[model samples]
Target: MQAKAYLQHPILGQRLRECTQIILNVDGRSAEEIFGYPDNLKFRSCLTLFMTATTDNKVFKDALLKYFDGKPDTVTFDILAHH
Candidate 1:
């Protein structure tokens, strides 16, 4: 959840767990945080989470596009800030 302000410590602390950022890596922390780890998640929860984190929808949209596009080498799931 790349956003402006700090709302969730669990995800924030994940930053500390990672030694470096890997482009589109979707590491453990990222996977768990974004996709709810091994647990099933609702689309609404994911949507709300993203919306809460992202203040600018346009930027978020762009980032997501590029992420899925797999073109940029700089976009990392570790800290893909969209604010």
Candidate 2:
């Protein structure tokens, strides 16, 4: 299922909303501002895990590089920090 759909699943939706609220309370920014949106955060986190799990895969590396538009390291670091 797509990240948005998965996030909308009742249990997962509640968990994500709770987490997002906590994050906003501490950071004072909406999840959209910090992570694009809940779905974007889910997608980025999944992609990060995929990249890490397949570190030797050239295709994953290439895709991640393209995802970050040539700033993969910096963007990945920021994403990691945010999560």
Candidate 3:
């Protein structure tokens, strides 16, 4: 499969970075320490799945809209879904 391009919007990029950072910060270990060698790629793939699901799911969208005061357009959910 072809790789998806990195998001062009700064907001989306920041969100993805924050998510990845949160995963890395779990258990007080750096991502490298936690994931080690081959598992790192698998971890990242799972992260992508997470991001995609969060964007595509209606429940998540509803929560996001509520959190951001109904500004659904501000989220790049459609863009994330395609990725």
lDDT of 2 by residue, 1-83 (tens): 24456455789655754553445354444334656756555544554544454333344344334444423444655755676
Q: Which stretches in model 1 have alpha-carbon errors above 4 Å?
A: 1-5, 8-38, 42-47, 56-83
Best prediction by TM-score:
3
Q: Which stretches of model 2 miss by more than 4 angstroms?
A: 1-36, 70-83
Ranking by TM-score: 3, 2, 1
What tens-digit string does per-residue lDDT give for candidate 3 at 1-83? 12223433467755755665555346545444666875654554444434454443443233333333334432344555665
Q: How well does each candidate superpose onto the true structure, as a TM-score?
A: 0.22, 0.32, 0.33
Candidate 3 CA-lDDT value: 0.45
Over 20-58, each residue of candidate 1 has an lDDT whose tens digit, in order, gives 123235433432365463421232233234434555333
Cα deviation at 79, candidate 3, in Å, is 16
Clashes by residue pair, model 1: none
lDDT of each: 0.36, 0.48, 0.45
